[model samples]
Target: MSITRSQIADIAHLARLALSEQEIPVYAESLSRVLGLVEQLQRADTAGVTPIAHPLPGQRQRLRPDEVTETDQHELYQRNAPQVQAGLYLVPRVIE
Candidate 1:
């Protein structure tokens, strides 16, 4: 699974990257080395492995009770807005 200089050049062209003549060889060598590493990984033994979300099983996110702790100043929050209307921050229209 060896990558060629031409393959790297083609990839760079497709990605709209302007690689220099010297940089092309560097990129080709770099990509080849990376792919070689992946090939080695593919040869390794991973027979029975279950993909888990948090790496640790049965671990839930620590969360406190969703209760109102303190009241916030509505006027202070609105003071920073460029435009505030009817106690709400007014956003610019996106539609033409």
Candidate 2:
């Protein structure tokens, strides 16, 4: 399923693409290669093969447990800020 220059022109018209004469051949070759790859994939046999979503086997992704540690010290952080207002940090507003 190869695409011709005239077909490319029609596609460019449909997609609103402004392609020059020089660019037409370049796009033609690239689009042809892409279509050729799709045709090759269509020729492959996948009759009884089960489609696996991911290359990895396990569905339950392994990750370190989301455990909490002793880090609940708010007053220590507010002291370092330039301006603290009612246990909260304040910044200058740029919007009107």
Candidate 3:
């Protein structure tokens, strides 16, 4: 998990970052500590653990009935439009 200065320089180049000579060693040390933490987490045991969609158990999401509750009001909405023809809104052409 020890990141070198050259590795930091390469990472900076790949990420399109401008890192000075002084900043390379600082980034290398920081990245090395992050990699060490990831390495420690990889050693943890996660066997026999069931993956859960929700954090709280026995909590089901309530859903409303899928049915039309309102009547058609197309003509009512079209009355507010400035220009509407053949049940479609008409707009001024912009592109040639």
Best by TM-score: 3
TM-score of each: 0.44, 0.43, 0.46
Q: What are the per-residue Cα lDDT tens digits for candidate 1 across 21-91?
A: 99988888888888887887777677897757787789898999999997988898888889999898887
TM-score (C-alpha) between model 3 and the true structure = 0.46
lDDT score, candidate 2? 0.87
Q: What is the Cα-based TM-score of model 1?
A: 0.44
Give per-residue lDDT, candidate 1, residue 26. 89
- Residue 35 accuracy (lDDT) in model 3: 95
Q: Which model scores highest in lDDT? A: 3
In the order shown, the candidates' Cα RMSDs to the true structure are 8.0, 11.2, 11.4
Candidate 3 off by > 4 Å: 45-96
In terms of lDDT, which candidate is stronger, 2 or 3? 3
Each prediction's Cα lDDT score?
Answer: 0.85, 0.87, 0.92
Per-model tally of clashing residue pairs: 0, 0, 0
